[model samples]
Target: MNRETLVNALLILGLLAAPFAADAMGEPFYVTLATRIAILALAATGLNIALGLGGLVSFGHAAFFGIGGYAAGILATHAFNAEPLLFGLPGTNQMVSIWLAAVAAAGMAALLIGLISLRTSGVYFIMITLAFAQMIYYFAISWPAYGGEDGLSIYVRNAFPGTNTMRPMSFFLIAAGLLLAGLAFFALLRNSRFGAALQAGRQNEIRLAAVGIAPFRIRLVAFVLSAMMTGVAGALFADLNRFVSPSMLSWHMSGELIVLIILGGVGRLAGPLAGAIVYVLFEFALGGVTEHWQLFLGLVLLCVVLFARGGVVGLLAGRARHG
Candidate 1:
């Protein structure tokens, strides 16, 4: 196999082996860590579709992520209370249902946000998105139903078909499956005609316009799809934590998502995955080594930005044109 194929193969093998090894070692914490990697990676993959492919530097993606988390939390709480969701709609605790709702909510929000943001470009676009996210964050904090400033908690982990999701390994596998599916989607999109247009629009919008293609529409579509994917990750994350709050909608969450992309190498398909892996590892390792771990993380992030350039993926795969 070529280098890329060989690297991917090894990575997949390592991820597949992680759960079993963690179980054998009688250490469930690592399983949770691995799950966090997968879920965050999935979220980053969604952002990559827009930031990497469409060159849309959205700063409000956390809105979608928070929406997804709220969807999961709200549904679980209502189901636990045996209350109706809305218009007498019965609340459900199924993971699939929660994910679907999260995706829908995020997609809808993206559509609205993209319509207005796409009218502007560059700094204006970034600031607009950030403003929208802040609005959502403040709203979540003010609203009391789903725990406003306080977060909503799930007493029991939600169930999935044919699996005891409460089990660490089982849930990890579920997250892994979602991650694999997301990767497949990314590959498919990257190779498709729309992907070509989106990438082209990013590289040379004027040329694309010369060819009679509207960069605005293409980017808007990409932005919405990106939000939807991140939304799914948010749903999974809420399930993982069994809690949801305004914190998920905050600007810090948006910054963290961007950090994942930049640290991994922007635009690379596996960049987010690699970044999530390294980021979590840093958090875990540094947390153990020092009380002021965040200070070290900031230092490391600065190094990555200045020295690494393309990110971990670029370091591994050679510099790509974008990322």
Candidate 2:
């Protein structure tokens, strides 16, 4: 394998090994840290599909992320209380079921948001998406049914078939598996005909339209799919913290997802994972030194944007060799 592929493999293996080693060394908190990286990477991967591939710089992805968290929280709450959800549907603490609900809820929200937001482009699109996210964030805060600003808490972690998710290692593995799956999906999409069309639309929508491709439809589908993936991450995230809140839907969360993608390598398949690793490391290492560590973080991000245009992955992998 070439350097890029080797680096990618090593990154995944390192992530896997680090947690196991941490667990063996009696540092379960590190395992949780690794799990957070996996979940955040997965969420950023979803954003990459739209921002990296389709050139859709959506600024409201937190809406979907929050939706996923709420889906898990609401479902688990009802299950814990032995209550039925809307339409007489019973609640479940099953991870599989909760994931499905998260996907569906986020997908529907993306569809509605995209239907209107996609009608515009450039700054308009960005602002519209951000507006939608803010609306959802406010609604979540005002909605008193689910604890409002205080957020909803899950007393126990959700169950996964054939696995004791309560164990940090087990949960980390689950998150890792999903992260790998998302990476694989991203790679496949980046190479497929649809992927080509999506990129072409990004480069020149008029040309793609001349070739009989509907950029609108392609982007809309991509947006919904992206939301679904991020939603799954949100569900996993809620389970990780055993809580759900409006904070998940905030514009800041959306911006962070975009920052992860950019920091990793905007269009690179493994960018999200790489970025998450760097981001979490920065947060952990810097937070211990100063409370205003974000100022330093911002400086680092500025350096990345100004000099390391391709992100950490791009820098390590070198520029893509085009024939």
lDDT score of residue 299 within candidate 1:
83
Q: Write the per-residue lDDT of candidate 2 for residues 1-323, one digit (tens) a residue.
A: 88788778988999999999999999999999999999999999999999989999999999999999999999999999999999999999999999999999999999999999999999999999999999999999999999899999999999999999999999999999999999999889978988899988988999999999999999999999999999999999999999999999999999999889888988788888999998898889999999888888788889999999889888999875422
Residue 87 lDDT, candidate 1, scale 0-100: 100
**TM-score per model over all chains:** 0.97, 0.98
Error of 2 at 253 (Å): 0.3
Off by over 4 Å in 2: 321-323
Candidate 1 minimal-lDDT segment of 10 residues: 1-10
**RMSD of each candidate relative to the true structure:** 1.6, 1.0
lDDT, model 2: 0.94
Model 1 C-alpha lDDT versus the unseen true structure: 0.89
* Clashing pairs in model 1, backbone N/Cα/C closer than 3 A: 266-323
Q: Write the per-residue lDDT of candidate 1 for residues 1-323, one digit (tens) a residue.
A: 55554555666667778878999999999999999999999999999999988888889899999999998999999999999989999878999999999999999999999999989989998999999999999999999988889988987888899999999999999999999999889878988989889999988999999999999989989999999999999999999999888899999889888888998888878888888888888889988988888788788789999899888877776766432
Say what the RMSD of model 2 is: 1.0
Worst 10 residues of 2 by lDDT: 314-323
